[model samples]
Structure formats: structure tokens, C-alpha cells
Target: MAPRSPPKRVSISHSFTSFFLGFLIPCINAAPLGPESDRVIKLPNQPATPSISQFSGYVTVNEEHGRALFYWFFEAQSEASKKPLLLWLNGGPGCSSIAYGAASELGPLRVGENGVDLHFNEFAWNQEANLLFVESPVGVGFSYTNTTSDLTKLDDAFVAEDVYMFLVEWLQRFPHFKTRDFFISGESYAGHYVPQLAELVYDRNNDTTRYPFINLKGFMVGNPVTDDNYDYTGIMDYAWSHSVISDEFYHNIKQVCDFKELYWSTECNALVNQVFDIYSEIDIYNIYDPKCLINTTSSATANKIKIDGFKRVTILAGGYDPCYSPYSEMYFNRPDVQTSIHADSRGEKWVSCKDSILNSYNFSVFSVLPVYEKLIKEKLKIWMYSGDMDGRVPIIGSRYCVEALGLPVKSPWRSWFHNKQVGGRIVEYEGLTLVTVRGAGHLVPLNKPSEALALIHSFLSDEPLPNHR
Candidate 1:
């Protein structure tokens, strides 16, 4: 077998946290400072906000690494005290869930095109459960490490370990949620993150003597990159069937490559690049979404922007701009915003996905399928969904992977409805469920917000999706 080349890295802040115990102690009837007390005091460009309370801060995960992970929590809009909690992660092996998951994908407020304003997202996931987004593994976004080597030493196992500790400390900070019904969710590279972290949680949950059990119920992943065989088959099929590649190009993909080797063969390198070139001029993440027309005048300016991190490729926001990366850079860079969130005092530029970390990720499991199988057997509510239009992590690959899971069907595949219209398809196999959101892309919630909300709402509530009327 030939040596495999490194996989391409694809991929995502805030808070003031110094309140003397006396600060809260002064009140006549004061509640102890809980994690919720890390509430966001204000946003740099916040608009008149809704009623939901929000929080942003760091949770130290590794003392030796001087590592800390950042998180943002949006309490459920109503009955938050009684609602379940959902942890949202974004997969980059090196990306920030805070930037991509919270800000652009499903968070309550999105950055407007002007880059200085916030707008409400009607279908924000907080409507269904209290949502918590974390920037993990010690090198992404507001998360950081004091040791120099720690910045580059990140992988799935390390990420899972750090995240596990993050949850422990987080709940300690907010003891009330220690027993709250909790679930894990994420997308893309997160296909690796959610399962591994859940495995740790599951193991600890079985030990009754642990300090806290984490009330873990189950998990969900969207457009995940799972086993190479199934993913390759699905990605090729999606591209060819969708006419994103020429018949010749599609033939090249089939004949010139052994899909199982995924990412390190000299023979398939040219063919792989050819396939990627198909969407070079478009947003490959959402093949159907409009492309960003970046207007850079000089190399110096472009280089500076790239060095500045998240805005490396400037895609201006418009309404809920389908473009995800650029607006994050604009909004997160403000000194005032950083102060409000109590972000790093050094004023370091933020990057959505850290190249330093990805390059140094020497560790990762080959596949998370075994983990999923175990979780399913354990009777966890394992759900998976994909946006059909995403060329990056195509829905075809997602569906194919689900079928390969080898579980007996509990419910025949069928259409799900919302607002009396066809929203998507659903299938159940014993303990796991598979879903596809019609007309959506890589970022499902951002593409089809209403449908995405319905999907999550049904999963969180443990109910069958509405049938086609």
C-alpha cells in the first residue's frame, strides 16, 4: 500500500467573566454564580434582541496544555428551565462550532451584509432546545492553548477528550443543567466528533458512581463524512447525477480511482483535483447557492485579509447570506465585540478553521461506523440528516452510508411533511433514523431553516415526522 497524503483541511467566539464573588454576594437573595451567569452582557452590533438569554465564555479543558475551549449558550426561548439542552459542534477536525454552527448555521442572530448589524433568524434551533456551541480542541476560535505544541497537536481523540472534560466543567459551572436531558449534534468533520465524544459519555454514564451522568439521550449529524467507500460512492453519484461533472469526468472518477484509499494516492490525485475544479467558481458547499464575488484590489490587501483569518476569502453577507465564512471575520474582529464577549485581551485575529491545528492533527480514527453501531445497540436516539444540494458532503453519500449500516428497517422510507407540503424523506432502522431535507445544501439549517427546524424539533421531541398530507 502506498503512503496516504494528508487530507485537505476544510472548515469556524466571545465574553467579560471577572465578577467578584462579592458582586453577586451583595444582593439580598443572591443565587450562586452558575454557568448561565456567564451571560453575554451585549454584542458589539447587537440589534434589539429577543427574550432568550445568551452566554459566552471559556471552559478550561487541559491544564498542562494551558488549553481552554470557548462556548456560547442560547437558552430555550420559553420554559428554558424545563427544556432539554442540545450541544452543537461543527466538524473541521479544526473548525469553530461557535462561528459556523452558532453564528451562521442555527444561532438566533446572524450577521447582516453590512457586517456591523445582527438580524433574527425565525427558525433558530433555540426555539426547540437550549443550544450550546463550542469551539474545541484548544486551537479554534476563542479556544486556545498556552503551550506552543498544543496549538498544532489536535485530532479526533484529543478533541473528544477535551470536549468530554468541557461538558463536565460546563455543567459544574451551571449545576442546574447537570441532569437536564442533553443531546449532541454537529456536521461535516463533526461526523468524527459527535460519536467519539458520545462514546466517552456513554462509558461514563454506565458508571453510576461518577460525579455527574450528563443526562445524555442521543445524537445527530448532518452531511457527515463517514466510511470512505460509502462516502466516495455517494459523492461521485451526487456529482454525476446532478450534472456537476461531465460524463467523461465522472468516468474518470470511476475508472481512475480506488475509492477506498481516500486522499493519498498519486494515481487518483489528478482525477480528484478535476472533480473539485467543477465547483471552483461556485460555493461547493452549497452548489446551488449564489457565488461570492470577492473584490480584492491587490496582493498585499488579499494577503492581509487571509492572514486576518476568517475573512481570508471575503464573501459579503446578504440577508442570511448563503456564504458562511467572510461575515464571521467582519463581526468577530471588532475590539468592542471582543470586550463584550470577554474574548482574548491580546486582540488575536480569529480564523474559522485553524490551519495550524489541521496540519498537526496526526491522530484520528479511520471510521466512526463502529461507534455509531454501538451507540445504536445501546438504544440511543441516533439520527442523521443531509441536505440534498450539498456537493461538499452530498446527501447521496449520507443516504448510502445509512443503508450500509446493516440495520433492519423499523419504518419503511417515506416522505415527511411540514406546512402541508413535502419537506423531506425519513426512514427508521430500529434505534437509528435517517432523513434528507429537500432543497438544502451542506449547511442544512442555513439553506432550509424551517424544514431543518422541523427535523430537529421532531428528533428532540421523540416523535414521528409529520407525514405528507
Candidate 2:
């Protein structure tokens, strides 16, 4: 057997922005905030004063290891105290929730194109629920650990434990939110993070000896990575059905590739690599969307070139800026911005997705289906949504994963409307509901904010997606 290569180091290139504005504020000592200290007075380059209260700081999960996770919280626009708390995570298994979940996707304020300013997102998720975004694990974003070995020990269990710890301590710091109905949401690899963490929270809540109950009512994930077998088979099928690859190539892959295998043969790897090579030319995240021509030098493209011997792709029509990733990296890395957010005081450079964390992250769990099965049996409200255009964790794969659950159909699949037009389709199962966001890609909120907002509103309300306009 050919020896496996060492994991490639992934680098995300920065797009330089010259615009700068000077803002001065009194220097406060860098420490995890008391309820008041964490309040964001103002952010540098903010286009307009914010109306809603925003708080950001670190919550130490492990005192011995000096491990802390950075978090940004936004209160609901109208009913600040009454809304449920919704924790949003972004899954790269290493991606910063602040970058994808906050800045680029559903945050109340979005990082502007120049990376030097912020703009209000009218359709932000906080419109319906208090939004919380965290840079989790020990090494992603501004979250850090004093012990370097902690980085190497990262895995699903490690992440879930630390995050639960963060939640416990965080609830202590903000005691009022302890009773709010809580729901966890994220996309991509978060498919793993969300369920695992939810299960952990569920188990802990049931423990009579445990302190500080987390009011976790339910969770929602989009384009989530579920079972390896289903995801693999679905990817190839989606690609071929979508005409992303030729029939000859698709048949060749079918002949040489066995999606059920734990490891692929070298020939399978070569065929998959060729598939990714073609995906490289397009924005695999959103196949129909134009590639961000601005930062062609970015190794972010290279980082996605191979997904452990499988390829992912998608397409979307234009409107959203594809350069949001680089812009987020540049904005968060700024000294003033970091200070305003009460991030790491040492001025450690921030990246949207940390390559080190991704490289070292132990992909020990092959499937989260069992966790889903466990949770489904409980009286928890679970919903899964997929961007139909997201090739990475395509709707096809999500459907397959959901189908594998073998739940009775509570509602037949039907078109759901938004703006008097068919937004996508929806169906309700015995213990789960699946929705599709039409025209959206991997990042649904970023790709289609209005529709995404509507979807979340429905989920939080426990109502079905609008069947008619």
C-alpha cells in the first residue's frame, strides 16, 4: 500500500484593504469579562451605532490547562429578555463560529467588503432569538490554551466536553440566561459537533449530581456531515445527477470506488483527486456562484482540493460576495477590533478557519447517526435544513441520512413559499423535520439571507415552513 502523505498545511490569503479609521477608547485590562466588562461599547469602523446590546469575551473551560473559548453574544432586537438563546457554531471541525456564523452569515453586523467596516444585516438570526457565536475547541480563532499539547488532543469528545464546560461557566457568568430555552445550530462539520454536543448536554441535564442545567430544547443543523457511508455515496450521486461530471467519469468512479469502505484504495484516491481537480475551477461551496476573482492566490482553494479522498461541489447564482472569508480574517486580525471584542490581548493573528486545528482534529467518529437516534427518542425538537445547491453536504446526502432514520412521515414533502414564490421543499417526520433552501449553497444565510432568516424563525417557533404565501 502507498504510504499516506502528511496532512498539508492550509493557508488562507488576505486581500489587502487600505481604508482605516481611528477610534480611541480607554484601555481596560484584558481578562474574562464580568457581566459589564464584556459589553461591547463600540467596534472600530462600525458604520452606525448599534441598537442592540452586544457582548464578547472568553469563557475559560479548563483552568488547569488555561483553556478558554471566545464568544460573541447578541441580544434579540426587540424582546431582549424573553427570546430563547440560540448558540450558532460553524463546522470545519476547526472553523471559527465568529467568522462564518457571525461575520459572514447570520450575525446582526456583517463585516463590510473592505474588511474595515461593519454593516447591519436586516435578516440576522438574532431577529428571532438571542444569537451566540463561539470560537470553540482550544486552538481556533481567539480561543487558546496555555498548554500546546492540548491542541494535539482535540477530538469530538474533547470539543463537546470543553464546549459543555464553556456553557456551564458561561451560564454562571450570565445567570439570567440559565433558564432560557436553548437551541444549538451550525453547518458543515458541525453536523458532528452539534449532535455530539447536544447529546452531551442531554446526558448532563439528566444527571442528578450535575449543576447548572442547560435548557437545551432542540438543535438545528444545515448541510451537516452525518454518516460517512451515506455522505460518500450521496456526493458521487449528487455530482453525477447534477451534471458536474461526465457520465463516463461517474461510471469509472463507481467501478473503482467503494463508498462503504473505511479507507479508499490508491486508485480510488486518484479518481477522487481528479474529481476535486475539476471542482477547483468552480466554487465548490456554491457551484453556480462566480469564484472570488479578487483573491486567486488564496491557499483556501488548495485546502479544499481534497476532502480525504472525496470531493464536494455546489453552485449558486450571483449576489453574495464570495470574498467574505478573507475580509473576515483581515477585520478580526486588526488590533483595535480584537480589543473592542475583548479577544486575546497578545494580538494573536486570527484566521477564519485554523489549519492546525483541522489537521490535528481526530476524525474518530465515522457517523453521528447513533447519536441522532438516541436524541430522537427523547422529547427533543430536531430539525435539519439543507441548501439544495450545497454540494459539500448536498441535500441528497441529507435526505439519505434522514431516510436512514426510518421515521414515519408526519408531513408529506411539499413546496414552501417565501416572497410569494417557492423557496424550497419541506417535510416532517415523526421526530424530525427537513427543509430545503432553494438557490442557496453551503452557507445558506450568506447565500440567501432572507430565506435563511425565515427558515430559522420557523424552527424557533416550532411552526412548519410557510406552505403558502
Off by over 4 Å in 2: 1-34, 296-319, 345-347
- What's the TM-score of each model vs. the native? 0.87, 0.88
Error of 1 at 50 (Å): 1.9
Please report the candidate that would top lDDT against the real structure: 2
Q: Where does model 1 exceed 4 Å of error?
A: 1-3, 6-37, 262-264, 295-320
Compose the digit string of candidate 1's lDDT tens values, residues 156-256.
76678779878877876766677689999999988888988898889877764433467899999999978766776777788889888889888877887
Predicted model with the maximum TM-score: 2
Model 1 is weakest, by summed lDDT over 10 consecutive residues, at 11-20
Clashes of 2: 7
lDDT of 2 by residue, 53-167 (tens): 8999999877878999999998899886789999998888779999899998999999987677899888899999988998888789888999999888777788888888788
Tell me which residue pairs clash in candidate 1: 5-264, 12-96, 12-352, 15-341, 15-342, 35-173, 91-190
